[model samples]
Target: MPDRRDLDIGELMTAFDAVVRANASLMTQLSSRAGVHDTALRALVLVSDTGYSTPTEVAGFLGLTSG
Candidate 1:
């Protein structure tokens, strides 16, 4: 483990920025190619929470479908 006291705020901020940038790049790829997969994943989460719902509900939550 690293020493928490040794962590500089500037270094932590830089690391956070790098992580956000990496995630943006990854989301761009998913949006460009497997966008529907992203919608499906969100729908899965909603179904898991509410037990069951129509495809329209899932799509609506993901901003892809309407009832």
Candidate 2:
């Protein structure tokens, strides 16, 4: 495992931000190719981030009525 003690917080944050921007860009591209709206793409990302496998959990996270 890498040494966490040797990592600079500022540098780590910068790297993380870069990766997030790249991921967002990729998601945008994929959304366009899939013909999905931005909201649906964002919801998919949110579901993946939250590790919610059930629609009920996703709906709760999205503040939607699970009907």
Candidate 3:
């Protein structure tokens, strides 16, 4: 196990935030490259979260109609 004394919560949180921002930036780039709209990318993320979602389910999650 690692030593607790070596841990800095603030620094760890900053690093985590940086990683999150970087990942978001990368996802935006990928979405743009794939010619996907922001809403479509968000729906894809929702579908991934649900593990097996239909268009209706995704639409509902996004407060949209599946029509």
Name the best candidate (by lDDT).
Answer: 3
lDDT of 3 by residue, 1-67 (tens): 6577556776798899999899879878989998998678878888788788986788887789745
On residues 1-67, what C-alpha lDDT tens digit does candidate 2 reach at each position? 5576557776788899999999879888999998997668878988788776587666666578745
- lDDT tens readout by residue for model 1, 1-67: 6677556766889899999899767666775686566555556668999999987777777788444
**Which pairs clash in the backbone of model 1?**
none
Tell me how many residue pairs clash in candidate 2: 0
Badly placed stretches (over 4 Å) of model 1 are 1-7, 36-67
* Clash totals in order: 0, 0, 0
Top candidate by TM-score: 3
Candidate 3: clashing residue pairs, number: 0
- Among residues 3 or more apart in sequence or in different chains, the pairs in candidate 3 whose N, CA or C atoms overlap within 3 Å are none
Better structure of 2 and 3 per TM-score? 3
lDDT of each: 0.73, 0.78, 0.82
For model 1, the run of ten residues with the poorest summed lDDT: 34-43
Q: Score residue 35 of candidate 3 by CA lDDT.
A: 100
Segments in model 3 whose C-alpha atoms lie over 4 Å from true places? 1-7, 53-67
Estimate TM-scores for all models: 0.43, 0.56, 0.57
Worst 10 residues of 2 by lDDT: 1-10
